[model samples]
Target: MKKILLLLNICIFILGKEIHAQTNFPYYQDIQEFKKKDSLKFPPKNGILFIGSSTFTKWKDVQAYFPGYSIINRGFGGSTLLDEIRYVPDIVYPYHPRQVIIYCGDNDFAFSDTVTSADVLNRFKILFELIRKEYPAIPVDYISIKYSPSREKLWNKMKSANRLISNYLKTQIHAEYIDIDPVMLDANKKINKSLYLDDMLHMKPEGYRLWEKVIKPYLIKD
Candidate 1:
């Protein structure tokens, strides 16, 4: 009876540790799924790699947008720039992409009120520097945070962060800041409600169509 009780306690402790780990690292499972897919057949190198939050992840038909170019979409859940920095090895480094386009920072602002535009910009800079450290020649592009009805309150902070990143990119070689926000606005310079889904957070097909048009010119062709 004593031995069984001791074994049970050990099992409980191990299980508890696993639960804690999952909570702490929210996208572990999502990344593992990507690994599983890659193990079957890894994508070709020197392709365009898109890494960020659900905006990219939810783009299930991203390949359709750009017909000729090879695209590896590594966007996970509603992840922040910090999460991209953490998982760079698993998502960014392995592929050796010719170009990396990012769409993050919005989630960082959404998730925490205290997180300022500068804070998010700093996080982005950390990520950019990390990538440059590994692949100095690789071209990196940033898609400006979109204006959405659901997160209207945080638009100002998002715009500020976008401007900072855009200016910073201008100072670096092989880096492009793809500003898609202005195109997303209507004739009156307001966020077009029709572009977003019912959630008013994630975009609809119209929004993605706009992205396809803007992002096409920036893609590098071998």
Candidate 2:
């Protein structure tokens, strides 16, 4: 009887530890909100699904920006590439989106001092593979990391990562690298201050207007 009691205590401890670990995960509440929303009404399958960090999350008018298209935004703020990878099964695959447009990697670099351009590329490749493995032939578009005044120090690293990913995408069918960095730059080849919000990181309405023009051409047609 004592042995049985001891084993039960161990099992309970292990279970509690797992629960604690999950609760402590970054953006756990955001993911749970998504799950709750899903339970209430599943997003339409075969629509364009946008997933990424705060950049995409803050684009609350995404659907309005692209009228006449079926669109679903699953972006969570303060998320990184790894966060998307961890939640892909919950936030991505279930939607069965016809196309996936991603805008990540910004927070990845901001959050880690040790991360490199190659590391970002490898992380993106992992996400690309995960999607392709499940939904072969579905088109995926990765929006290049933008040049922001706030993250000027990491500009070179972000540019290098974009270059690597863009080059790799060229070799894969149904994969596209949307480069909007150039447009975000002024004629002097510097970040246009007018495009960003006061924080100098996130974009303003003007910035998204530029993004819309650049990205619309690549969007899949109905």
TM-scores for all candidates: the values are 0.89, 0.88
Q: What is the per-residue lDDT of model 1 for residues 81-169, given as tens digits with 9 covering 90 to 100?
A: 87787777778889999999999989999999998887877778778887998899989999999878999999899889989999999
Off by over 4 Å in 2: 1-22
* Candidate 1 ranges with C-alpha deviation above 4 Å: 1-24
| Colliding pairs, model 1 | none
Model 2: lDDT of residue 75: 93
lDDT of each: 0.87, 0.85
Give me the displacement of residue 167 in model 1, in angstroms. 1.0
Clashes of each: 0, 0
Q: After best superposition, candidate 2 residue 214: deviation in angstroms?
A: 0.8
The TM-score of predicted model 2 comes to 0.88
Report the C-alpha lDDT of model 2 over 132-171, residue by residue, as the tens digit. Answer: 8889899999999988899989999998999999999999
lDDT of 1 at 174: 98
